[model samples]
Target: MMIKNTAIIDIGSNSIKTFVIDQEEKYSKIVGFDKSMSNGFDGNKINNFDTFVDSIKNSINKAQKQSSSKVKNIILITPTSKNKNHLISEVIELNGAQIEDNHLRQLNKSMIIKYKTKLTHCFKSHYVIDNKIITDSPIGINCGSLSLNAIATIISDEEIKLFKNIFSKIGLNLIFIYDSSIIYYLYLKSLNLHKKNIVFIDIGSSTTKILTIKDEKISLLKTLPIGSMNITNDLMTLNISKDFAEKIKTKNIDLILNDHSSVEIPVWEELGKNQKQTKSYEFIQSIVTARVDEIFKLVLSSIPKSKFFYSYLVTGGGSMQLNLIPYVKSKFGIELELVEPKQVKGIPTFWNNPSIMLPFCLNSLIENGYIDKFNLFKKNDSFSNKIWYKRFVDLL
Candidate 1:
């Protein structure tokens, strides 16, 4: 048997995580994992590009060393802080009853031209036929010319340039660049959630991404900028130190603090509760609960009500909150489940906890050949036509 190693690096607003796995036909436990927090690129321009690149490179380098495997191919999931919107287009065309590569190419060409976008990856796009849903690549089957419907998750060109520059600095070729939400969809597929109408939620430090899968294909997606970090900020503003605020935020106390408390906050704490309890456990919970509720509301409004399904499958560092799961369930009237990324095949079982290892599962899915990439654009005519190329060479 041959041993293959695949590495996936997810760069997000909160932290940068790397997952390295040994790949066979079926992925096994994770072999290597690395995570670095406090990159601090949220809600502001990333000024230290060099430091950021070094941070990304160091994560992969550390994972490779710990996992003791050589990487063959790298799948990159880029940051989605700039914008999140749905770009939908419907095309009705007829090319006889037989569909082949030419038809696909022609349709892809026209789409790229009209949208002014380019294809960089290959992913599944489904269409509604008759009353049932069908995938586009149903070749050698009987059908009309075709009515194609597509919903694309697009990241701006400015973001792509940032990604290219980061990868270029590390001297690694970017085989594919996909939104983190797509990577999450690939992760969901590994868990058998892809076949059903599932809402997969990735609650990170700075943003929460909601991706909807209906009829086994991506149907809708929405992202919220608020995340677990907001809870910390809430505590910090109450004049509590970072260390103590984090502790109080997670600790469960019998005392119930209301939304409107007159607790005065101090810069630091004296180990135990003082007379002036500026930040009470109840207060923190209220703030967290309210913000999380607002986040979910925003997500709910963006997607169709029918797509909510039974519940939301949640993951990411924020999922660790014990109160969050129950709160979300009762408030939204939806079942909530946390994704254990380590349990997935291809990811090493050494670190199976979701508190900090959610990205590892995403990495494993990409390595195990479960994730699909969408090509945003086709190669333009200038690249294929020799005459245009020759003219450009002469000018150079």
Candidate 2:
């Protein structure tokens, strides 16, 4: 059963984006792309359902036209608010048979049933076969019994229903939904970069998602109520429109660009009036750095000892604040790596913008056989399909 072309919609606080891709054998043909302002989404919730649907429709239609394909299935991705981390362990007997992929699949299925009321997503931490610990999947090894630890996110039923209703209004099925942070982490892990210990961060428009990979297995997932939008709002202290504020925030707030506090930038009270004032780069830096620093402090509170991780990788619009790397080094003494999606054959150069890169990665991961066919977790018969989310990844 080969699904030829599919659409990926990324709904974020600031915008709605879509990519209509033609999944090919060796490469994904990216035939369509769009990023549109989100209406109906008032940062925290969908306040106007009708307007929200319109917004999503606009984004989807623009991309679909470019692809010349009517996309029916959507792998929806969002930076959802309700995600929280939980640790679960499950054990099973193999009866001295060789541990195969199905063995772990069954083990995970059992674990989900026990916690079906809670799990939105689950990722393996590691496995112990016959009382011996292993990070690699014990697929071919003969084992009497196997046990595993996993990190899973708990999503609210309310959120899932909201997704359903939104898609229903748009006249499309909500084939699958994924939390952006979790999917972003999954895409990275699939690269097999050999990063043993890492604290991955994504600063989205209204939320910051953090996930930890310790000892080559995922350990935790977290979401915080902070993002680049805060920085833009903070710049409104000068009484500029949100549009103008966002422009300068993106243009000036950078490591190489914003470093000279001694330099001053011109500020306009009303550009048409030609009235102007001067503010030191230091002023803007203070406002921007303060919020970014707070974001990291909050991350530390959630996952203490993040400083000990071998790598601190970050993405999303906030990562464009190049100064953050040196700033975190000075404040917390942690090195931060700005992760960009690697160039797969079909990805256009502009598609790598951190804010909208998740869809591209999702398309690539699907083609590369990195993502499991796990249907959000096949907990019941209603999700009828040969479900994928296997090993969630074969890393463990």
Candidate 3:
């Protein structure tokens, strides 16, 4: 028997990554992985198309080499950071027809068609069969009609088309295209966190999203233009390189400690001699504090207070900053929990990094049988074509 290879490519403002898994792997464990620095993108447009294309190709090539398998099809994750809350429902009058998976699939499709949204991440799902209330699923039941109520997250169609063009250039077919925020939400939901007035905040390199789940219904409160990169940009005003600024921001700066008044940084002096430049630790802490404060002010003023409160959770590349949780707790008067997926046993250790949590947890969700509910093979455009692609379908 031949092994079937599947891949997931994640494109974000920070990096382009490739993760591989095959039928031979146990529990959908990631068999191979590689990444390269991303050039940049603004919505549907790539900043440097040629350079970006090369990065994508190189990342995939390296991952394939590591896994020693040619990828049959790919699941692409694009960081849209686009979140619009839309409540939509679709009803199917079966006329005494038995409900099957196809009916459930059609109802989801109908909601997308009528709602005019390209992507819908149903945070809350329900099925009403005939006159009976069913929250789980209506499959295998003979019912007169069924309806699906979904509180979905919507993204623009152009962003998806942008990825399709990239796929064609890379000579790969996509199994599914998902917004990074939705993937984060799915991974968060899979963990089954404490549910009373929870706020799911995903702070990326360039953007931040706040999704409030109150009483089982999720709402997209805001997507702010501010992010961790902005803090790094602010640090650059101290006459330091951006790379050094970001490095210290993530690993060195400690907001919880006030023991130090100034920290010395090594600098090159007059060709060969090395000199130290002293920076005030208080000033460094002030820059980060001000940036986070700005984000809080914008969030509070823009959204309804009724939707924001209690149980705060933070994740993403930005949340990896040291001592952030304690700082947030002390300043905001709300406890901040750093959300991380429990490590899967019997996998390589690098799978546990919080920086790659987006893809790692997504892979876990697939392992836990969440993707089965999506009917991805039945409806995705990338899997719809080609006879050879069917071989990989059984692996799903």
Candidate 4:
């Protein structure tokens, strides 16, 4: 059945974002968009369950209101960790000149077989292959072997349950669970400008999601523990309030200071000290720049340059760093582009604005029926199909 209006909720380490959309056979209409600070789930940690659940409900309600329609299906995308071993193995084999269509299929089957314990809904596999990466089904090429590097992520069942339970409590029908990275990648694809080798670094508040897309498919997916919170932690170590530290971090303004230049550093009351003087930008920038540099270098290493692919895209909250883009370009000497979600069609003009663009695009895809296209995998019948499996195994 063609569901009318669809809604998508993306729960990230930094925010809870929602999108509502409707599409006919010919056209798609984005009706609503909303997001709220719900960094309840940060990386593998859940700080406050109550606050997270409440924030989710509020975001969904706002989306429903803006759309002026009941949410037919809600696709929840969470950053629960995924296993990347299978994809890595596939890349290794391909690089070893042992890859074929059958090999790819075997890898896919093995992924499901291994992670069936965690998977809960229909899904799709997107391969981001560097030039070194080889496939048996090469469109039109004759080469000895392909040395490819890949990153694959498997969404977890428990993560889906968290969103489903939240929706159930809020009186909404849960649709399919999605990979937030996948959703965001599709948003980039819709732009049609990023059809080359590109990596998207979504540096959120507490966690950074590194994704590489090549040949219009996901090549690598990784979630790192480092994020903007590290800068806050650095400030907190100086005994400063989290709020004040956040302000300074965001401003990113460096004031020229002589030897007389000094900034107040908070000292703990237990230590019986009010404030200590220190140079403002020198110390903080050293910590922040070092962390940010490590992240960029790590992302660069993940992209195999031998593959002849060279396009990097930066986004998310940490990208708000004023000098980050230029600094990355100057430091890495690789061409990097900032992704603009407002460039896509059917996206409302308001959402085209800063910061909200990525989530807004993701929310619209879910609210519309586009998310339904992702439910391509059929339910498994392992019990009844045991004989077929056995026969297949015998052939192998």
Q: Ranking by lDDT, best first?
A: 2, 3, 1, 4
Candidate 1 scores a C-alpha RMSD against the true structure in Å of 6.2
Clashing pairs in 3: none
Q: Where is model 4 more than 4 Å wrong at Cα?
A: 1-6, 22-27, 65-67, 70-72, 83-154, 188-195, 214-217, 238-243, 254-279, 304-309, 343-358, 361-375, 378-396
Q: What lDDT is reached at residue 234 by model 1?
A: 80
Better model by TM-score: candidate 2 vs candidate 4: 2
**Higher TM-score: candidate 1 or 2?**
2
219-279: candidate 4 lDDT, tens digit per residue: 6777777787787788777767777777666664332222333456555567676766576
- Off-target runs (Cα >4 Å) in candidate 1 are 1-6, 22-30, 69-74, 83-117, 135-142, 145-155, 189-196, 214-219, 251-279, 306-310, 344-351, 355-358, 372-396
How far residue 285's Cα lies from its native spot in candidate 4, in Å, is 3.1
lDDT for each residue of candidate 2 in 56-116, tens digit (9 for 90 to 100): 9899888888776787767777546665666678999888998889878788778777866
lDDT of 3 by residue, 106-178 (tens): 8766765665324334443457778565545578888788988665555455555566567777887665665
Steric collisions counted per model: 19, 7, 0, 10
Decoy 3 TM-score against native? 0.78
lDDT of 4 at 80: 60
lDDT of 2: 0.71
TM-score of each: 0.71, 0.83, 0.78, 0.66
Worst 10 residues of 4 by lDDT: 375-384
TM-score, cand. 1: 0.71
